[model samples]
Target: MKKDNANASLQARKEAATPRGVGVMAPFFVARAENSELWDVEGRRFIDFAGGIAVLNTGHRHPRVVEAVRAQLDAFTHTAYQIVPYESYVALAERLNQLVPGPHPKKTTFFSTGAEAVENAVKIARYATGRGGVIAFTGAFHGRTMMGMALTGKVVPYKTGFGPFPGEVFHVPFPMPLHGVRVEDSLKALQYLFKADIDPKRVAAIIIEPVQGEGGFYVAPPELMRELRKVCDEHGILLIADEIQTGFGRTGKWFAMEHHDVAPDLMTMAKSLAGGFPLSAVTGRADVMDAPAPGGLGGTYAGSPMAIAAAHAVLDVMKEEKLVERANRLGGELRERLLALKARVPQMAEVRGLGAMLAVEFCKPGSDTPDPDFTQKVRARAMDRGLMLLTCGVYGNVIRFLFPLTIPDAHFAEALSILEASFAE
Candidate 1:
């Protein structure tokens, strides 16, 4: 691959080989990445605010994570945990069981993606409670799998032409004060769901993202979470927190659920769990996890040894670097900058999120209508200036900031400046 032809040739080949359904956000292909920076094949450097779609919260190729994966590769990679189990897998599970926000006796299971963890969590919930229905909030993005797509709330790209999704899965409104859907409105919708849709007795679980990930970084109000807990307890429904994007130090905590006093019955985690390696987990009450028989769960590469090793190293890196505190500090700085920009850029309607998992929403000036066109222009302008940004939300008017918690101070400032310039453009 010659320097001049690097990106163009590769992109042409990719178009020929890959299906269009698999979206490509960036036109340039990555040659390498370290911490919060990426180098394209053409050698153009980019400050990565997308963070590989929130999967590199510890940053790309953290020394500890790389060292751990290298060591695991030297020994072995996969053993199929259900067939030939490894100690590291069990150790990782134990660590998660202890760290996840519940005092009740808990157990953990590993998978390969956030969607897998969600599907397994739903399976476990149904098996434990012997129910056929599950509930999810509007504006949630579980994954692309059948169950995940069914649970996801957005329609255009995620659910368009992809359904007939799974049956017995329902969606209720999520609280969005900016959009006029208040906590009371969301709670009342749940009540209406029980009355007009599925019976409470037949509903097994209610899954929600602590901060809406793909739906624009709308933080779930703590009060709404407490109310959900109360409702779940009242109806004997299991509450599952989909923390795939909000876990690790992205939200200044090990998990977003820690932000609230209430703890969920089951939690799905992934994305940053194994750094860049693929890994996901579902942790919950011991009794509930045990509801499925020994042969009833697991996949071919459910707990790959390399990913387990990476996950252990990720935990160590979080503690040693104090990335949780860094998330809080960085998030505050970023929010302050965005708020200042919002004052000048009338399209900047809101800046909201928890910790470092922040987002900026754009709307038409003097109106609440979403300004997706302006949002895309900002993203494109930022990319042209070597800053990679990601857009989300059902309206496509949000620019989410998922820069690594380990991002250097200098790079953070540079990225912020680039963002401001993009908005100005």
Candidate 2:
């Protein structure tokens, strides 16, 4: 047997073996990765600003996470929590229940992916309220599943040919002042939706990302949140916070919802929850979570023992290393740098997001026209200089930074340099 350890070969194989729907951003194949850095099969090193799409808050293969998984590996891997439950799963649920917001008691259930968490959150909301309608915001991204796609707002790549999506799912504009959408506009739209589209009483949940993830890193306005909570209370509609991308200290707090005053009835979290392990959870008001029947919830691989163990270690590492505070510090520094760069880069339209979950939108110089081409150029230049970056937004004109919270200080500074050079070139 011969080992063909080349990125070109692997990329060719991947293209031939995989479908076109699964987009590949980087042309290189990863050979190894560590905290904030990865080497390609060609042995080229690149600073991982992508962070596995915001999954590696603890960085790749953190020693603590690795050790915990190793220990769990020796004991057992999977027993199907719904069949033979494990203590670690229960313990993790307990931890999440306490960590999630709201003064009332909470309950939690685990899933394998963020999409699964979103799907189950919807199920729980409908069961609890006995309603079938759901409201999501435009430019929002829930997931790739049928139900996830239905709840998602953007339609190009995520919903182009996948419909007919699940019925009774509605969408309203999300507030983006730069894009001319205001909070009042959003509220008025929601009001009109209730009047013209679906009755408020028939809506089960109003799901939103505290910081819109794939829709571009726009922070949900606090006023909007307060209004949503008020409306939910007024009409028995449950407010579901999709914290999958903004949870586990990526946003400087345990969850982005913490940055707001009101608490949601339910919250879906994943990505960084298990330090790169496949674990997602939905924590909500105890009664709301309990609405689903005993056998009504769960997955075959939900709450795997290994992922549960890794999640425990992720929590420990977060506390011991103080990653939450680190997020604020790093995010502040990045924000300052980007703001300074914005003065020089006329195409840089706006900088937004909370904590370390930051993004910069690109537009035609001195104009509102989205410049996705400039955004692509910046990403390409950064990749050429040994840095990885991600682009988002409905128009694909935004550059999102998702560096690991545990990134080494020196590496972080180097990535910043690469970023500045990318924009300059």
Candidate 3:
């Protein structure tokens, strides 16, 4: 591949002009990506474990997704789902209503991003209950917007200096086994909050990541989901499951809530909703979603025709390829491998996750010292070896694995070998 010197020069010029608020403005630029592989402008190949931050569940440039977008583009690209009705939008919504967990009749709406989905879920909950407060969890990463940042639990980085956030958003503990916060203890914490702070009756919803994503790969205990249902039943608060990162077969199930045998009153989903295209959704019980007045839930590009078409193809790919089952198989293999590595390296503090969304945390052997330095070292070393990886958790001592469900077995093994070598170093 010939280097586009003109394009590269323009990119370099723009890099200096771009603001820092965009987050991931990586120094390198991708010339192309197919399946689970990415080639940079300079023609360096990388096995993409990041998957556009788990947005390419179907893999990069999947033929089905690409074909769908092309077909839709040939027809009409956008008119806005609200201003002009689109069959694909309605079809995707129907599919979501049917696929999202719960036996009850449900309704669905589309949004542009996960943050928008979350914001609308809260709005719908409050509208239905006629209440003001909502609850989230610590170490949770919702989004960057004010409302999202307010509901988010962390202080530094996300919530720092961006004070005076939206009120009525409370946070409770998410019981993490590695942290010794048990399910019962988390429930007690919620109880204490209800008694000391706003009454549960005034709370509109309790939103939780079925598996805490940015907070580390701590899977929420099944008992905790049951408890959340019980509390919601008692107070009539909606249970909003944020499945942004966990949905779309990243978890073994279509939705992570399936592991708990419970259903959210509302659910927010995005990331891999439309291959790599920007799309998100808010699906839930029909009545609650209907609570908000007409014209209450929508965006300029809420359900873009192109994204909806790609989403239809994505759903097709996930089902036809049986990616959910693949996620289960991949997660088991990953966990087994990580545990085996633990036996080899004592720094492997824990190996935990559901489906393909796995993580390996590191700490100083027997002590409680979170070895974030070690985690960063491993990440940098792995990146050097052409295997891209990411680190998360409050202490940044956890490395989350988000390989594409469609990654080839050969590439997967190669990435693992690189990871092992990095850990060894």
Candidate 4:
């Protein structure tokens, strides 16, 4: 095989072998990846600003995380935590119970993916409150599972063609002041749902992402969070913070929910939880978590020893490296750069996010119309210049930056330069 045609050949093979629904962005296939860089099979180096969709806060193959997984490989791989419990699982759960926000006693359960954690969270909420209805905000992305689809607001790509989702799931507009959706409007919609749609008493949980991920990097208003907590208290609904993309120090804090004054009743976490390993968890009030009977929750790979070891190493790396603080510093610098560039790049409608989880929305220069085409051009130009990027938003006009917190100073600066160049005519 010619080295020059490696990517093209792989692309052909991928199209033939894989389902089209997977939706891969890059045209090249990766040969290897380090902290903030990866080389394609054709020996092309690209600075990774996507961070594997927010799963590499500790960066690719961090020495400690790799070593921890290797150590676990020698001991034992799988015993099925349900069948034979392990000390590591319990210890990690204990750590989370303490680390997760909230003054009340908490309990945690492990899962293999964010979707699994979300599904289990709803189950726990329903069992705890004895309700079947759930409310999710428009533009919020929970996951890709059936129930996740039902809970998610966006229809294209994720929920398209796959219909007949789980019933009793409802959606209200998420407040995006830029898009004319206000905090008051969202609360009123919730009230309308209670009066017209489902009874508040029948609602199990109200799930949200403190910072919307796929629907663009819109931050949830503090006022909205406070009101939701009050509504949950008034009724018997559980408040679930979906922190899958914003967890593990992506948002300058351990979790995005920390940005709010009020704490959620339940929280779903994944992505960077295990420093790129497959691990997710649901942590909530001890009483609420205990609502489900034993044996009711637990997957074959729910709490694999390998992932547990990776998670422990991830936690250690976060604390020792002070990643949470790094997030704020890095985010501040990037925010400043993007803001300064806005005057030159008229299409840059807004730059928003919490901490390092930032995004720049593109729109028509004079009007509020979304410019997905302009957004794509920015992504394409960046890719051509050897910088990888990711886009989100219902209109596909937002460029989100998910570079690893562990990215080297030189690499990050180079990527930023490439990003600024991407806006040039």
Candidate 5:
């Protein structure tokens, strides 16, 4: 084969010129991706464990999603819902209202990203309650926008030097079994916040990720959720479930909060909502969502026709293929396999998660010290063997599994074998 021209290696050249802020995950260039795998421009195949950061629950380029996007492409790309409303956007909303938890009449508004969905949820909640303060958790990652940075709790890369965020955003401890943040401790933190930080009544909403996706895959304990629900009801504050990373059957249930049997007044969903397309939504009680007056919420690209079409297709595929059920089956096996591996690798520490949204937390043996270096080594080794995985958690010592539920069993088994061998090496 002859050497290719620089024009043919645009991605590599572009990386050299771009600022480091434009962070890249895997170094390989994607010539194409399908189901649970990626093919690099050099034609190397990789088992995809990142799943586009949990935004490809149905997998990359699912046939149905592709056909839907292609069809929409022929019809038209954008007309701007605000300029002229489209049926698909409304149709998608109707589906979310029915799919999301709760018996209350629900309404939904679409945005282009998870951050936008979360930010708008806060806006709707504040407008509804006429309050300025809101609360989040210590390990939470709401987004990178100014208000999102304010809501996000981690300080290092996400918050460091990016302070002077929007005011009145409070933080409390998020519960994790491995860390022993019990329900009582989380509840008391809320109580203490009322006493020391801000009045509960002054707060409009308490936003949280049902499963802290970026904060290390800690499933919020059911008891903690029930307590949060009670306190929110008592204080007349809305419970805003941030399902940006856990919705669309990433968790065993349709929504992670479904496991708790409590209802949130407001919900923000994105990520897999559009099967890798840019689409997100804030869905909740009709009256609460209506708090934002006309013209209060919307963006130029909100609910683009292509994304709405893909979203509708994503919902259809989830039900048609029973991906929610698939998540439970796969997640159970993943957890069990991890437990079996734990008997061997002391670095594994603890394995926990719900549905397909699972993680293995690494800590120093017989100690609580976070083992970020071990986690980093595992990821580096995994990458060398053609497995693309991601590490998360405030401590940066967790390896999360976000493979598409639609991945073939053979591929999944192969990936697991690769992981086991990586550990052995």
Candidate 6:
């Protein structure tokens, strides 16, 4: 493929071969990526702030992760964990059980994707509680699988024509103060849900994202989390933290749940677990996890040796390099820049997030109406200026910044400059 035509040619072929359901954010195709930089097939060097949709907290190809996967490749690759278990899988599980928040005894199981982890977590919760109903918040993005999609609150693209989804799943409002939804309002909604829809005794779990990922980077207020914990305890319903996007130090902590005083009964994690390798997990109370009998939860590729090796390295890199502290430092700097820019950019409505998982929302000048068009323009302008950005939120007016926690100071500065220019444009 010639350098000049590589991107366009591949795009054309992609259009012919792939379905529109799999959305493509950028027109250009990537050839290589390292840390926070990506080189497109056309040889364009761009600062990557999207971080592969928050899957590279350790960065594109950390040497440690690469070396670990390479070593695993030299050995035998696949032996279904159920058919023939591996020591690495058990070790990773042990590490997670110890690392995840909560002092209670915990156990873990692995899967291939975030959706699988979530789906299985629900299964475990239901089996443990002997209930059939689950409660999710509005604007939540659990996943796209049947149960996941059913649990998710957004509709347009994710749930449109995809349902009728699984039954007995309910949604209550999530507090978004910027949008006029208050914590009290959300709490009331949950109360009303129990009274008007599903009975508390029939509810198995209440799953929520620490920071809403696809619903926009809205941080779940600690008060609301604590309230939810109380509600779960009152009703004997399990609390499941959907940390697929907030784990692995994206939120400046090993797990986002650590930010709150209460701990989840079950937690789903993925995205940055293996530094881009496909792996996910559900870690929770030992008794709850063991509710599912043997042979109930294993997948053929649940704990691929290569992904397990890469995950071990990811954990090591995070600890050795202090990426958790780096995430806090980077997030502070980025939020400060965006807040400062808001003074000049009238459309900059709000800048909110936790740790390095930050976002900037846009609205029509002097009004609360969301400005998705302006958001799109900003993203396009940033791309033209060689900075990869991602737009999210229910209104599509929020620009999320998921740059690798490992992004260098110089490259981070350059990306910020490009972002400022994009806002100006």
| lDDT ranking, best first | 4, 2, 6, 1, 5, 3
- What is the TM-score of candidate 1? 0.99
How would you encode candidate 1's per-residue C-alpha lDDT over 258-357 as one tens digit per residue? 9999999999999999999999999999989999988888999897899999999999999999999999999999999999887779999988999898
> Which of the predicted structures, 1 or 4, would earn the higher lDDT when compared with the native?
4
- Which TM-score value belongs to model 4? 0.99
Whole-model lDDT values for every prediction:
0.93, 0.94, 0.89, 0.95, 0.90, 0.94
Q: Output the TM-score of candidate 6.
A: 0.99
- In candidate 5 the C-alpha lDDT for residue 422 amounts to 74
Candidate 1: residue pairs that collide: none
lDDT, residue 190, candidate 6:
94
- The best candidate by lDDT is 4
TM-score of 5: 0.97
lDDT (Cα, tens digit) per residue for candidate 3, span 330-376: 78887887888887778788888888999988999886578999898
Candidates in order, TM-scores: namely: 0.99, 0.99, 0.96, 0.99, 0.97, 0.99
Residue 304: error of model 3 in Å? 0.2
Q: Which stretches in model 5 have alpha-carbon errors above 4 Å?
A: 1-12
Q: In candidate 4, what are the lDDT values of residues 82-109, reduced to their tens digit? A: 9999999999999999999999999999
* Model 5 residue pairs with clashes: none
Clashing pairs in 2: none
For model 5, residues 35-92, the per-residue Cα lDDT tens digits are: 9999876777899999999899999999999999999999999988999998999989
Worst 10 contiguous positions by lDDT, candidate 6? 156-165
- How well does candidate 2 match the true structure in TM-score terms? 0.99
Cα lDDT tens digits for candidate 2, 1-425 = 12445777787789899999998899888889999999987778999999999999999999999999999999998889989988999999999999999899999999999999999999999999999999999999999999999999888899999889899999999999998999999999999998999999999999999999899998999999999999999999999999999999989999999999999999999899998899999999999999888899999999889999999999999999999999999999999999999878999999998889999999999888999999999999999999999999999999999999999999999999999999987
Instruction: State how far residue 336 of model 3 sits from its true place (Å).
Output: 1.7
